[model samples]
Target: MLAAAAQDADREFSFNEQEFRYIADLVKTKTGIVLADHKKNMVYSRLARRLRALRLESFEAYCSFLESGDSEDEMGMFINAITTNLTRFFREPHHFDHLAEKMSEQFGNAPTASRIRIWSAGCSSGEEPYSVAMTMAESLTRLSAYNFRILATDLDTSMVANATAGRYRLRDAEGLSKARLAKWTIQDRSRNEMTIKQGLRDLITFKQLNLLHDWPMKGKFDAIFCRNVMIYFDGPTKDRLLNRFHSCLAPGGWLYIGHSETILEQRDQLIPMGKTIYRKALR
Candidate 1:
C-alpha cells in the first residue's frame, strides 16, 4: 500500500477530489456523460495529456481554465480525450446481421424505389455507418433504385472529420471479411491504409452532434444505431435519450443500442425485437 501510494504521489499533476468533481459536473452538464468515482483514474490519465499539451501545471489549473469561459476549443479537446472510442468494424456482428434481415424485408416485395434513412448516432471513426452501408449494398442488389442515405454523427469534431475523410489504417479493417474488404474499400497495400469506396462513401453524411442537444434532423430514421453510447449516461439521461430516439424513429423502425445498455423507459413505444434491438411500435 505504501508503494502504491508512492507511485500515485509521483504523478506529474495533482488531481484532488474537488478537481475531479468539478470535471465530472462539467462533463455531465455538457455531454450527459456520468463520470463515476471509478472513472477518476481514467479521467486523469486521459486529461493529463491535454494538460501537457496546453502546458497547464495541474488538474486544478485545467479546471480553472475551463471555468474562465474562454475554453471552448479546449473543451472540445477535453471531450475528445475522455470520450472512449473503442470500436472496430462490426464490433457487434449481430447488429449488422439483424440490419441485413430488415433490409431484405423492406425491399423484398417493393416494386418501386423508396427512400431509406439510417442514422449511426455515435459513429466512432465512421466504421459503424460504413458497415451499415456495406450491409445495405450486400442485401440490396440495386442500390441506385432507392434514395438510401446514412447520417453519421459524433460529439468529437476530430472524429467527424476523420469519418468524413473515409480513410483508415488497414489493420483497422482486419475484422472485415476478405470479400467485403475488397468490395467496399480501396486498399493501398503499400501504405497499409484503406479508403472506403466512393459509392459507399456517397451514401453517408458525417456531422458532429451531441445527443443531449436539439437534433437537427427533420425526418425520422428507419434504423438508428446508437450502440455503446448510452452506457456513459446516468439512468435518467439514458431514459430520456431512449425516449428521444423513440420519438425520432419511424413507426416500425429499429433501434440498436450497445450490448451493455438496456432500455428501461418508453417500453410502450420501443418494443424489443431481438438482443439489444428495439422496434418503434406503430401507433
Candidate 2:
C-alpha cells in the first residue's frame, strides 16, 4: 500500500481523465489520429516531454496554449512529438519487390516514352524514399534515357529537414547491400555515419506536408507509398484520405499502405493487388 502511494507521487505531471479525452479529441481532429482510452498512459508519457520543455505545469496548460494559438509553428512541434516515426531503410522489403515488378512492366517496352513519378507519403527520416530511389536506380538498365521523380513528404518539419540532409547513422544501414551502399552512399566508418551520394538525393524532393491539408503537388503520382501512416486513424478518416489518394493517383496507379493498415471498404475503387497493395481502378 505504501509503495503504491509512493509510485503515484513519482508521476511527473498530473493527467486527469478529462485532460486525456481533451487531448485525444484534439489530436484526432487536427491529425486524424485516434487515441483510445488504453492509450492514456502513452499519451501522458509522450506529451510530458512537451510540458517539461515548455516548463508548463500540466496537460491543461499545454492544451490551453494550443487552443490560444492558431500558430502553425508550435502546432508543428506538438504534432512532431505525438506522431510516431519508426522507420528504417528498406523496411517491408516485399513492397520494393512489387515496385520493381511495376517498374519493369511500365518501362521495359517504352522506357523513354513516359515519365515516372512516385510519392512517398509520410516518408519518415528519408529511409523509405531513399530506398525507393535505390530500387529504381538498380532496376533500370537504360536509366539515362528516362526521367523519374520521387516526392517524399512528412508531417514533421524536423523529419523533412533530416530527410533533406540525406545523412544517416551507419548502424541503420543494415538493409543496404554492399553494392548499393558503395554506389549510393558515402560512409565515414570512424564517425559511424553515412550520407547519401548526391546522385541519390538528385532523384528525391523532400517536402513538409500535413496529410489532412490541401496538397500543393501539381501532378498525379504513378505510385504512392503511404505506409504505416494511416493505422493511427479511425475508419472515417481512413476512408476520406483513401478517397483523396484515389483522386490524386493517375489512371491505374498504385497505392501502397502499411502492412498493418487494413482496408475493409472501397474495394470497388482500390482493387487489392494482395499484401495491402492496391491499384486505383482505371476509371
Candidate 3:
C-alpha cells in the first residue's frame, strides 16, 4: 500500500480509477467517444487545465462539478477540451482527386441539374471544405448555372468559429498549389495570414454540430466528407453513423472517409468506389 500511496502522491491531482471510469462513462454517453484504459494519461493531462481554471482541487471534485446540473457551460468546455482537432489543407489528396474526376460525370450529364450539395461533417478548421470549393470551382464550366453549397460542421464551437472566419496562417496553406493559392485566397502580409476569397467563402456554411445528436439538414447531400471523425467512436457508433450517412446521401452520392476508416458491415448500403471512398447504392 505504501508504493500505491507514493504513486498517488506524485500526481498533480488526485486521480483514481473510479473518477477515470466516471469521466469515461460520461464522455461515451454524451459524445459516443470511448475512452479506453490507455487514454487515462491523455485524459488527465487534458483535464488538468480545467482543474486549474475552475480552481478544483481533485479529479473527484471535477467529476462532481460535471454531475451537477449547473455545469451546462462547463460541459461545453469539457467537450471542446476532449475533442481532438488535427488537420491540414488537403491532408488526403486522393479524396479530392476522386471528387475532381467524378464531378463532371455526376453533374455534367444532367444539364438541368441545378443543385450540388456537399457536407463536411467533421470539418476541422476549414481546409476540407475549402478544398472541395476549389475542386468544384475548377471542375464545372457553367458555375453560376447551379446552386452549389458546402456545409461544414464540427462538434467544437471554437473550430466552427475558426472555420467561419475563413482565416489561416500562411504555413497552414503551404500544401496548396500556387494556382489555388492565388485564385482562392487573399494574402495579408501584415498579419501573416491568408483569408479565403469571398467566392470560396460564399460556397460554404460553417456551423457547430454534435454528430451524436439530431442533424437539422433536410436536403440530401451529393457528397459527404466525414473523414477522421469516426476514429473516436466504438464499433456500434461507427455502424450507426455509417447507416445514417447512407440515408443522408442522395441516390448514387459519394462518401469520403478517413484513410484509416473502413466499411465492414455497410457494404450492401455503400459500395466501394476507390480507396476510402464509397458511393451510396442507387435504389
Candidate 4:
C-alpha cells in the first residue's frame, strides 16, 4: 500500500538535521527560497527522487556532491526538482476578472495609444500567461488595432520551455468553460492532448528569468502578475522585487500578488484595489 511505500521511502534516505540545514542554506543562497523545519519531509520526498535519478545512494552523499564544484551543472536540475509548480487554468478567477476590467478600460478610452505590456512573473508551466492571452484574445474585438505583448517569466527554464510549447493534456481543460476551451485551444482526441493555436500563442513571449537577479527588460509594463511567487522568498527579497516591479510599471499600472502573500514594505507605492490587487501610483 501507499502507507507502506511511504514508510520504506522514509527509511531509504538519511537526512540529518545538519545536512538539512546545509541544504536550506544553499537553497536560500542560490534561489532566495526560505526552507524551514516544517518542510523537512517535503524536501526529503522531492529530493529523494533526484537522488535516485542521479544514482546517488544517500542524502549525505548528495549533499556533499551538491556543495562541491561538481554540482554546478546539476544545480539547475536540483532547483527544478525542488521547485513547486502547482497551477491551473483560470486559477484565482478574480485576477482574470480584474484583468478583463483593466483591458476594457484601456480599449474604451484609447485603443491605439500605446503598446499594452503585461508581465506574468513566476508563470509556472504557462497556464497563467496563456489564461491572460486567452482572456485578451476573447475580450479584445479589435485585436489588431493596437500593439500588445505579454512577457511570461519564471526561474525554471523547463517551465518556460513548456509554457512556450503551449501544449497540455486534454483532461487539463476540465477547469475551463466549454466555450473558453473551444475558442482558445485545438484539441487532439487521438493524442489526448490540446495545444494553444498560433493566434493565441503569438501574443506572449516566454523567457527564463530570475527575479532576484538583474532583468534584461528595459520597458515598463501595464500590469504585472506575480501571484503565489513571493511566498517562498524572505522579506528583503520580496521588498526588493516589489520595488523593482513598482519601477517597471507605467503610471496607473496594476500589480497583483498571491492571495496568501502580502507586501511587508512599501505601502506608499501601490494602492490595493481588490482581492490581492494593487494599482501603481505615478512617481
Worst 10 residues of 2 by lDDT: 1-10
Q: What is each predicted model's overall lDDT from 0 to 1?
A: 0.90, 0.88, 0.90, 0.87
Model 3 agreement with the true structure over 1-283: per-residue lDDT tens digits: 6975786789899888899899999999988999999898889899999999999999999999999999999999898888889898878999888898888787876665489999999998989899888888888877667888899999889899899899999989867998888888999889999999987899899998889899999999999999999989999999999999998999999999998888989999999988999999889
Backbone collisions counted per model:
0, 0, 0, 0
lDDT of 1 by residue, 170-208 (tens): 999867999999899999999999999998899999999
List the candidate 3 regions with Cα displacement exceeding 4 Å. 1-8
Of 1 and 2, the candidate ranking higher by lDDT: 1
For each candidate, give its TM-score against the true structure: 0.96, 0.93, 0.94, 0.93
Candidate 2: lDDT of 257? 90
lDDT of 2: 0.88
CA lDDT, candidate 4, residue 197: 87
